[model samples]
Target: MTFDPVMPGIVLAVAAATLLALRAVALLPAARAGRTSVARWAVTTVALLLLVLAAARPVTGSAAGERNAQRPQEGANIYFLVDRSSDSAIPDFGDAPRITAMRSDIEEVIRAHPDARFAIIGFAARPSIDWPLSADAWSLQPAVDALTPYPGIDSTEVNAAAAANILRYQLISAGQQFPQAENLVYYLGSGAGESTVPQGVFDTPRIDDGAVLGYGTGPGEARLREIAGQLGLPYVPRRDGAELPSDRAPESGTATATDPATAPQPTELYWVLTMLATALLLVEIYLTTRDLRRTRAVRRQAPS
Candidate 1:
């Protein structure tokens, strides 16, 4: 229940006006006669409206949220660790290389599972959070769109270190509310030869997460990237080459990606607004009926 304003002031004003109007209507004699408690009704409407508006969370620009599945599913929290360092610039995978392809893949993943709380992180010579764990894919998607290969300092950190950082953050944010079996990590990197973090970092007993995918064709080929501004800085070389490590045993995991067409689309804000309005209307109807009953009782008791 948070509100970000693309037009915060306007939304607040509208909400306030609506609340006042409801209050005025509730104060009228006909409306007043039927309520168990008008004050309580007014307060409840306001509270409900606030909750609805909080979902609005107006942003300066359009943002997307994942729709509920046709079959209800509890959202799984997942984190993404990306290799954004200078090395991805090696024209590694796409015509533009691995970074762009990786970015596109991320956007697709988020588009499909927009409701999933996710964080995007970049590791090169070092690690920095591109987007923290959030349900509001509104901001998170943009963070994905803004992925660039341009120069930042030179510091390459291992994907494991980044995963560790992501794990730490998830624990802090979810706290007691954390769902068991809810957390997963996807590390999409070249698995560059050397990194400071332990190889089993994602395999520990404390957090039984494992790296899902690796990109690049040859040995040490996956680790290629450059931070030059030609592709606008932190670009992975332009090649479609990727590899599943020969050393590790293969297993089916949740990290398998969906086709672009079949991927999920975002839930529209207006639909949410409509549902909220419908709920409010139902509440109003109930209140009206209750009030009518009270008025009838009053008349019955009045002198004929």
Candidate 2:
């Protein structure tokens, strides 16, 4: 048996001992018989021990189960192509910064597709993977939260074709890594905003699934819609109550997606321990009250 004590074992031991000692001292001048006093002391000690056990939080499982907790499975791979251009920092989205809106949208998509693994590509002058593909959604939070628009790069001069090429490369790389998973790309930006694309070089890459999600309060939405049309992907414009279209990714049904047959299961035993401790406390209370009543009855029977 192993113990994962909430507090240090020595600290709990000292607390239990100190409490019992204080109780023993309080009960010394009582009119109860020696055996009754000892019985009360034992009950108190048992109650204390039960409480400590509950706090310790014991668990029993094989070593193999823990090691396989994060088993990979077949699901969609979501790639977030986020634009961190200087234009994205404009504070017009819901009267807040556009970057704020982008973060919210990315998180919303993550929650929507619980089964899918995710990667993040932050694009300004050029696109690069801020976060690699992983099933752990929380791993991408810090990078997104700390996202700031790159300085000294004019959004007007960004090359859309070059940025798209980087995205294509990352998507192909992720596809190679997880061949079984479907690729879904979510573009969170006002696409190609004032970014020049040389004539005959505006070729849009083929995306298997997902849409171009536009975020702005200006003419960028029109440009984004054009980009989406060219890429043959659906366009979702930012609005007060806009929703991502249904064709993006497959939804997780009633069953939890993470817990596939191959994944290990984690079982918690804290609730059982807590219940046991509560039962012990009730028993201790009953015994103490009964002993007090018996002592009072004996005193009443004695001559005064």
Candidate 3:
């Protein structure tokens, strides 16, 4: 059993204690008068405790199972290095902006690897991690959709390898953390940028699969192909109305995808605890009402 409290543990504890203390004090006079039975007080106390437990959001699972639930099972770790340079806004691929092709290709990659963990790093004048590596792949859509090219007027020279160092560090860290998981890198760009390809940046064996998807027509297209060759990834050019080929074979073991039947899922006990608390509260209410009616009858029978 574990707890993922809706509120801070200390705050919940203090609140529960305060409520329990107040309830005890409020029932003291009734207890002395014999109007509130010990059973009623006991039931209410238990109910209050149960209510607190429910709020704490308890989950039942083994420690190992819980850890497994948090970590991605044997699946690819996909890193998307997107160029948000001013050139990316140039409408060249079938009269659509390079960003449009980038978005489409990203979605296609995501769909191709449904179980893969995804991360996004967008670069223009500089690089920034738009999203961290996570199993929730669909959550990355909004971030990708919101990407806009860096303002042309104020834009500095965007280099192809602007995010190379960051990508290297992330790949190393990910390799260390999840050695069994394959690391895939997708570089999406118009390839119209200063060629600052760092030496041996893509030399790491961590990169297992992915591609360099170039957009638009320019002399930089050759540079993009060079970048793809250095990374030992496929180079796909997005020409007029050209879409990414869908026939690419899955590289990793598809059978290794996390099976829902065997996956460790936290058993939420909050609702169960809540139901018990409700039942106890109802019993407490019934007992209190019975005691009130008995007191009223006794008062009526007494001489003035």
Write down the lDDT of every candidate, Cα atoms only: 0.53, 0.67, 0.75
TM-score of each predicted structure versus truth: 0.46, 0.56, 0.60
Candidate 3 lDDT by residue in tens digits, 78-148: 99999898888888767788888888888998887765678899987578898877655544788879987
Candidate 2: misplaced stretches above 4 Å? Answer: 1-73, 196-206, 217-219, 246-304
| Residues 1-304 of candidate 1: C-alpha lDDT, one tens digit per residue | 1233333466677877777686677677546567656655664665567555655553222222232322023344667777775555667464676677778767666665534567777766556777766666775766887776548634334443444555565555644344443454555666555555433233222333424444555543333232121111132332354432221222565432122344354433534554666676677778779989999999999998
> What range of 10 consecutive residues in model 1 has the weakest lDDT sum?
226-235
Query: In model 3, what are the clashing residue pairs, if there are any?
Result: none
Candidate 2 structure, TM-score to reference: 0.56
List clash counts for every candidate, in order. 44, 0, 0
Q: What count of clashes does model 1 give?
A: 44
lDDT of 3: 0.75
Residue 176 in model 2: shift from native, Å? 2.5
Candidate 2 has an lDDT of 0.67
